[model samples]
Target: SAVISQKPSRDICQRGTSLTIQCQVDSQVTMMFWYRQQPGQSLTLIATANQGSEATYESGFVIDKFPISRPNLTFSTLTVSNLSPEDSSIYLCSVAGSLSYEQYFGPGTRLTVT
Candidate 1:
């Protein structure tokens, strides 16, 4: 099992300002994923960051809006750019386990854009 921790557990940000969230894993991981959970909605995958390659953003998410960095196997960062009220959501970091279907998640970063 992997232990994941996210920084800035919760924050209140003004509209149009961006926030960068950090995710750290206790052990080295090959697959790290970023997700967003909007109010009253299910988790949506933002991107997948591998250790050596560029992150792959999901259909609705773009690199311009959500830039992800995977500097090494144990750390990654996701920055939400040009924030807006609708961007307020809980951002979560997750890593895949040995099993294909198994995943461990970090305590989410809750962002409230006012």
Candidate 2:
């Protein structure tokens, strides 16, 4: 299994601004995913960052809006562009357990847009 870590556990941003969240894993994992959860909702996958290649974003999300970078197996970054009130949520970094098929999540970066 891999242990994931995220930076800037929380932040407050103004509308139209941007914030970047960083994720790090203890060991190389098969997959890494980025997710977001609203105040009272479940996690929504934002994208899959492939090492050395462009990221694959989910529907309703785009590269221009949520740019991601995976420099290597143990590190990745996600930038939230042009923030809005609706963007306020808990952003998480996750890794798929190699053999257990379990998923481990970072504490999360809670953003409050105003």
Candidate 3:
């Protein structure tokens, strides 16, 4: 199992500002993903960051809005650009484990845009 941790567990920002959330795993993992959980809503995948390749974003999400970087196997970052009040949500970092169905998630970064 991989242990994941996110930085700036909670933050409050002004509208139009951007925040870069960091995800760090204790071990090298190949499949890392970013997700957003709006208040009272289920998780929505933002993108998948694979080492040495460009991050693949999910529908309704664009690379320009949520740019992701996977510089190596154990580290990744997601930057939310041009934030708005609607962008306030809990951002999570997930990783697929050795088993096909196993997945682990970080604590999550909670952002509030005003």
Candidate 4:
């Protein structure tokens, strides 16, 4: 099993501002993914961060809006740019496991744009 940790368990930000959330993993992983869980909605993959390469973001998430960086196998960061109330959601860090098809999540960085 793998474990992940995220900073700023929760925060309230103003519109047009930005917040960068950090993620750290306990062990090396082949794939590290970022997800967003909005209120009353399901989890959506924001991007995939692999070591030594540019992060691959999912549709609807552009590099300008949600820039991601994976400096090494163990650490990554996600920045929410030009924030809006619509961006208020639970941003999570996840890592793919060896056996399980599911990924493990951090407690999450809950962002509230007011």
Position 112, candidate 3: lDDT: 98
In terms of lDDT, the poorest run of 10 residues in model 1 is: 8-17
Candidate 3 total steric clashes = 0
Per-residue lDDT tens digits for candidate 2, residues 7-110, read 99999999999999999998987578999999999999999887988899999999999999898989999999999999999999998886656789999999
Cα error, candidate 3, residue 36 (Å): 0.5
Candidate 2 similarity to native, TM-score: 0.95
Q: TM-score for each prediction? A: 0.98, 0.95, 0.98, 0.95
Candidate 3 lDDT trough over 10 residues, lowest sum: 96-105
lDDT of 4 by residue, 21-84 (tens): 9999999887888999999999999999988998998989899999999998889999999999
lDDT of 3 by residue, 50-87 (tens): 99999998989999999999999999999999999999
Q: Which of the two, 3 or 4, has more TM-score?
A: 3
Backbone clash pairs for candidate 3 read none
lDDT of each: 0.96, 0.92, 0.96, 0.93
Backbone clashes per model, in order? 0, 0, 0, 0
User: Compared to the true structure, candidate 4 yields what TM-score?
Assistant: 0.95
Query: In model 2, where is the ten-residue run with the lowest total lDDT?
Result: 95-104
Point out where model 2 deviates above 4 Å. none
How should the candidates be ordered by lDDT, best one leading?
3, 1, 4, 2
